[model samples]
Target: MNSLWSGSERVRIVERLKATLAGVVELELLRCKHLEMVDAALEDRASAAANAAELPAEEGIRAPGSTASEAEHGSTTSRRQQVSAILKVIRGHIGACVGPVFNPLLSPSLSPGYDFAAVLEWFAERVDRIILLFDAHKLDISDEFSEVIRALKNHEDKMRVVLNKADQISTQQLMRVYGALMWSLGKIINTPEVVRVYIGSFWAQPLLVPDNRKLFEAEEQDLFLDIQSLPRNAALRKLNDLIKRARLAKVQAYIISSLKKDMPSVFGKESKKKELIANLGETYHRIEKEHQISPGDFPNLAKMQELLNAQDFTKFAALKPKLLEAVEDMLANDIARLMAMVRQEEAAMPSQTVKGGAFEGVMTGPFGHGYGEGASEGIDELEWVVGRDKPTYDEIFYTLSPINGKVSGAAAKKEMLKSKLPNTVLGKIWKLADVDKDGLLDDDEFALANHLIKVKLEGHELPAALPEHLIPPSKRGSSLEA
Candidate 1:
C-alpha cells in the first residue's frame, strides 16, 4: 500500500497512539467510566419511555391497563430484559480480555503498552483499505496468521488480496498458484463469496514472463482504481459498517436472552448451560424463529458456543423488547436518514478522476477532455488559466470565502480536502499558491491552488514555484496583495 502520510505526519500518528495507550490503573478507570456511561444512557431511555407512558390519553382514548397500554408495557419490559442480557454477555467477555501488561524489559520501546486488539480497532477506523500482499510462489498460510486474518472477518469488506510476483512464473504455473491461494484462503475466511484478488508483479523490474503483461497491467489498474475510490465512499462505508454492527449486536442479544430464559432460576443452571452449548444449533434456529432474525445474521456457531461455555447463564438479563425496538428503529430510520444524506452530498460533489497509475487516459473531464488536451485547440495555454474552468474555480473560491473575498489557511485547507490529495502534496501546492506570502488565499490564490491540484490529479508534476505567465493576471506586480 502507498503511504498516505508524509514522514512527519506518520511520526505524529505513532506518538498519538502511544499517548492514547494508558497504564493498568488508567485503563481500569476508563472501563468503569464506560460502563457508567452505558448505565446512564439506559436510565435516560427508560425514563423517557416512562414519561411517555404517563402522558394522559386523549379524551376519547383508552385509559391505563387497557389492552394497548398493557401490551406496550409488556413490550417495554421485555426489551429491558433483553438489553440486560446483552450487557451481561458483553461485560463477561470484556472482563476476561484483560488489557496489555506493563513489562519492565521493554523499557525504551512502547510495544509492551500496545494492546493488539485496541491497536487493530484504532487502525480499522482510520484506514480506508487493507491490502494483504502474498507471494505467488508460496501459497501456504501459517495457522497463527490465519487466525489473525479470521479475526478481521468483521472488516472483510475493506480487505483486498494481492498475489504478487506473478511475472516470475509461466502463465500455466500462475493459474495453478492462483488456485492454490484461493483454496488456502477459503479455508481461512469464513464467507460464501470469493475474496477479490489482484495478480501482478508489483515492482520496478521488468517482467520475466511477458505473455500475461497486458493482464497484469489491467489488474494493477483495477487495484489502483479501487484504492482511489476510498475517499469518495468513506462515509458510506462507515455507515454500512455501523449497520452491520447493529445487526450483529441485535442477534447476539437475542441469543443471550434465549439462553437466559432457558436456564432454571434456582437449580440446574450449570447443566442447563451445558445443554444449551451442546445444542447451540437448535438454540440458534429457535432464536431466529422467535425473533424473526435472519439466519445469516448469526455469528459462527463454534465461536458463539465457546464464548457461552465460559459465561454464567443465570446472570444473563431477560429479554427487553423496548431496547431491541430502539435498535430496530435506528437501523430502519436513523441509518436510512444518514445514508440519504451521504448520497445527497455525493450527488452534489463535482466529478473527479485520477489521471495516472497503471493506466492513462482511463477517465476524462466534464467535456470529455483528458489532461493536457487544452493545447489541442491551437495555442499553448494552461487549462485553468485560459480554459472555461477558471470561472467555476472562482465560484468555488467565493463559496469557500464569502465575507472578505479571502480564505484563511484553515478554511482553504478544509476546501482542499475535497480534492483528496495527500497532505504533503497539498502543503507544496499551498506554498506555490500563496504568491504574496500572506498566509491567506484571495480568490486568485485559491484558484491557483485548485489548478495545481487538478494538475497533480492528472498525473502531472507540480512546479517548484508559480510561473509568471501562469500567475493570475490581476496579481502580477503586487507585493503582499496576491
Candidate 2:
C-alpha cells in the first residue's frame, strides 16, 4: 500500500508512454483555459462593481468619496485576492499530481554501478547530454536493463560511459574487463567501434574496513589519484554542446510543436482521461502478446514481500499447525518412500543387542503418554529418511488446507497436535522451522522442528525424526557415538 511502488491500484501501466505524453500536452492547455475562465470572471465582477458605483454618480445621489463606494471597492479587492489564492493552489497541484503516471520504467541491461541507467536515459532523451557510470568490477551487463539497452541503440553518440571503481581490480583484470565490456556493449548495443569509457572511481573514498580493504590491488591503492583530465574533457564537451543547443533550442521547440499538431488523440474525449486509460489498456494487451513480462522478472520484489510478512511471528504461529499438516499430507508419499529406504538401510546393518533407543527416546519426549502413533525410526537412518529440496511454502499450504484441495473436517487432527506442544513454543513455532528464511524448508527442517516442540519445549517423547542428526545440543555427541 506504500507509495514507493505500483501504488496506483486503479490504473494499469504498460506501453502507453505516448498516451501519457499527450496528457502532459493537454494538461497545459486545460490549465490555460481554466485560468482564462477565472480571469474573465474576475474582470466581469470588477466591471459590475465599477458600474454600480457610477450609477450613484450618474444619478447625482453620491457624496464625495462615499464610504459605501469605498466599502464596495474593498470587497472587490478582497475577491481578487481570493481568486489569486485559488490559482496558487491549482498551480501547486498541477506540478505535483503526475506521480501515478510517471513512475516504474521498463528497462534492462543493468550493470552494478549503473542502477539508474534507465532513468538517466529517459532524462537524456529530454535533454542534450548523458554521462553514464558503470563499475569496472562488474564486467557484464544484465538483461534487466532494457531502457539502457534502448538508449545505447538510439543515443550512443551522446553517451559517455565512465568505468568506475578502477582501483578495485588489477590493471590486467581491468583491461580484460574493459575489453570484454567494449566487445559486449558494441555487439549488444551495436554502437560505434569505439565509445568513450573513462576509468575512475568517483565515490569509493572512505576509511576501509578489514573485509572491504582487501578488495583493492596493491598497485591500485592510490590509483587515479589525480585523474581529472577525462572528466574535464567531458565537461568541456558538454559546455560546447550546451552552447550549440542553447542557440538552436528555439528551432527545436518549433519542430516539436509542428510534430504535436500531427499527433492525434489515441481515444475520443467522452472523458479524455478515461479514454487515455483505456488506450493504455489496449496498448498493454498488445505488448503482452508481443513481449511476455512475467512475475519471474520481479523475483526480488516477491522475495522482499515474503521476508516482510515472515516478521509477523504471531500470525505465522497461528497458521503453523495447519501448514504442518498440509505439508505432511503433500509429502506423505515421499515420506513413506524414504521410510522404506531407511528400513532397508537398517536391515543392511549388523545385528546389535536391541538396546533401548526408540522406546527410551519416545517415552521421554512429548510422545510420552501415548501421543505418538507411528512405526519407530531405524537407528542411524534418521536424516536420509527425509529427502532434500526443502518443502516450499506453497506445497505446505496446498497440502494442509488446499485452496483447491481442502478437507471437510481436519481441524480436529490439528487440535490434537497443538495439544501435544506447550503454549510457549506454539506461539512462534514457524520461526524455528523456516531455517533458510526463504519462507520454506524441506522435510528435514519440519521433522527437527516437531522434535524440538515435543522433546525440548514440552519435555515429552520425540516423534519420528532424524535420531542422531537432530538430537539436542547436549546429547548430540553421545547420540552420534551410540
Off by over 4 Å in 1: 1-127, 142-146, 183-192, 309-312, 350-482
Output the TM-score of candidate 1.
Answer: 0.47
Candidate 2 has its poorest 10 consecutive residues by lDDT at: 94-103
TM-scores of the candidates are: 0.47, 0.23
Give one digit per residue, the lDDT tens place, for model 2 in 1-482. Answer: 12222545213322232333343334334334534655677689979977777877788788667886577667656755664575467442201111111123322221222234444443454433345556777755655443455543455555556666776777677779888878766766564457766665556485222232333322222222112222323333444443333223222222223223323446442354333333433433443354343322221222223232212111111112332233333233333443444455545555432224222453355434332322233234545322332344234433555332322224213632664665555434445443443444334445444434544443343433343444434434544575
Best by lDDT: 1
lDDT of 1 by residue, 219-296 (tens): 876887786676677679877866766677677767777787888889777888899899999988888888788887
Count residue pairs with overlapping backbones in model 2.
17
How accurate locally, in lDDT, is each candidate?
A: 0.67, 0.42
Q: Native-vs-model 2 lDDT? A: 0.42
